[model samples]
Target: MEIKAIITGCTGMVGEGVLHECLQHPDVKEILVINRKPCGITHPKLKEIIHNNFYDLLPVATQLHGYNAGYFCLGVSSVGMKEDAYAHVTYDLTMEVANTLAALNPEMTFCYVSGSGTDSTGRGRSMWARVKGKTENGLLKLPFRAVFMFRPAYMHPTKGMQHTQKYYKTLSWMYPFFRKFFPQYVSTLAELGQAMINVTIYGYPKKVLEVKDIVAAAAITGK
Candidate 1:
């Protein structure tokens, strides 16, 4: 069966990689992208919905149905932001999108690109981790056919650039070295994209897949 997909954060590094993978797949017939700004890419199968605020999507909630999968990749760095401001972006914005999509398409598979070391225990001191964990938990609670939280560490991209991810970008270049020394904490962007597409296409029995599991799944699928 042909699959239709919705992608948030299409301008980001990982998001762009996933977008490329989805477009390349013959199984994916259409890809709807929602972002604050334009992704600047034009394709016959791609639909870009430019919205200044996520809350504005409520009016078009009914139009979001029938998608086979959704990739929620939108996120912001916690640097220089207050706790409430950070939470609003990391937790509130995510929940808003998840809830809207869940209501519109209960049977859709939701795949979230979460980072490593997310504190599922909401009581953790790290505000970012806690917010991520909360968002992950909330997404799982929704009525989707399947919900997957992909916690990837040191994602090395195949293309594009993320100037903000300076440290990770540098580490990405040294991925070969990092993999040799600490294979457990790293995964390539192509691998991560492949794994997410596989999960959305084939589905997983579990609710969450940590960094190691994501890498393992990616390796298995890539081969």
Candidate 2:
């Protein structure tokens, strides 16, 4: 089947990586990326919408319709942030956009970029984990055809992507070591991107995919 996707957070590392993979994949026929700022990419299969407000989707919700897949990679760090503030962006903001997309595209296979240590119980001691847990649980309740929660740890950034975080570069030298010793905790950005695309097309046994599952899923296409 041809894939038409709505991607968010293209200005960030994860989103950019997924967008790059989608542009290269033959099955991906159309892509609509909604970002707060320009992602500075152009392709025949890609369309970009620059919108500042995610809280209210009334403005651009119409443009969001008809997509069969949603790659929701937008997220914020919780460093020095209070629980309520982190929840506002992590849980509240994500749910708002997700709900809008669910209403617009009921058959959409939604992929959410969650962290490795996320707590699905929503009662975890960590603030960020709890918020993410709530968000994940909430998304499962929505009426989308399929919703996959991706929990990747120490993602090795794809080469030549400019939006990579500075700290990832510093820690990249450890990726090979991690891949050999603790493989389950690491996956490449390419694998992460391919995993999302593959799961959308071929479905998976589990709804929540950890690093190991991500690697296995990515290998399916062999691109």
Candidate 3:
């Protein structure tokens, strides 16, 4: 199945990596990126939108149509943020955008970038985990054709990408060791991006993907 995907968070590490793959993949014919600012990249298949507020996408709703897939990578860290503030960005904003997308394209395949320790039960002790879990649960209730939650732990940065996180670059050499010893928790950005595409094209048995599932999906060439 060919893909016309709507991607968010192109300025961040994961989003940038996914956008890179989408632009190069033959199966992906068109790409749309919605961000507050320009991502400073150009491609024949790419279209960008600069919308400051994601809390409401009504202003850009007309621009988003005929997209069968969505890659939601927009997120913020909870390290120093209060619960309300974190939820506003992580949960509230995401849901608002997702709800609009669901209404616009019910058949779209939705992929969310959730961390490794998300609690599906939403009863976990960690604040961020619980919030993420709640978000995941809410997303599953939507009417999209398929919904997938990716739980990646240690991600190796993709080379030649401008938005690769500095911390990831610092530990790039250790990825080989992590891949050899703790394979379950380690994955490359390339694999994660490809895995999402594969899952969207060819539905997987499991909806939630760990590192191993992601790697296996990336290996699949045909839908």
Predicted structure with the largest lDDT when compared to the true one: 2
Q: CA lDDT, every prediction?
A: 0.81, 0.93, 0.92
- RMSD to true structure for each model, in Å: 2.1, 1.3, 0.9
lDDT of 3 by residue, 1-223 (tens): 8999999999999999999899989999999999999999999999999999999899999999899999999988899988788888899999999999999999999999999999888777898998898899889899999999988889999889998888899999999999999999999999999999999998888888888888988898773
List clashing residue pairs in candidate 1: none
lDDT of 2 by residue, 1-223 (tens): 7899999999999999999999998999999999999999988999999999899998998899899999999999899999999999988999999999999999999999999999998777988988888999999999999999999998998889989999899999988998999998989999988999999999989999999999999988644
In model 3, state the lDDT of residue 54: 97
lDDT of 2 at 95: 94
Model 1 lDDT per residue over 50-116, tens place: 8888955876676687897898888887888888999888888888898888888887889998888
What's the C-alpha lDDT at position 215 in model 1? Answer: 73
Ranking by lDDT: 2, 3, 1
lDDT of 3: 0.92
| TM-scores for all predictions | 0.92, 0.97, 0.98
- Residue ranges of candidate 3 with Cα displaced over 4 Å: none
lDDT accuracy of residue 25 in candidate 1: 78
Q: Candidate 3: minimum summed lDDT over ten consecutive residues — where?
A: 214-223
Give the TM-score (vs. native) of candidate 2: 0.97
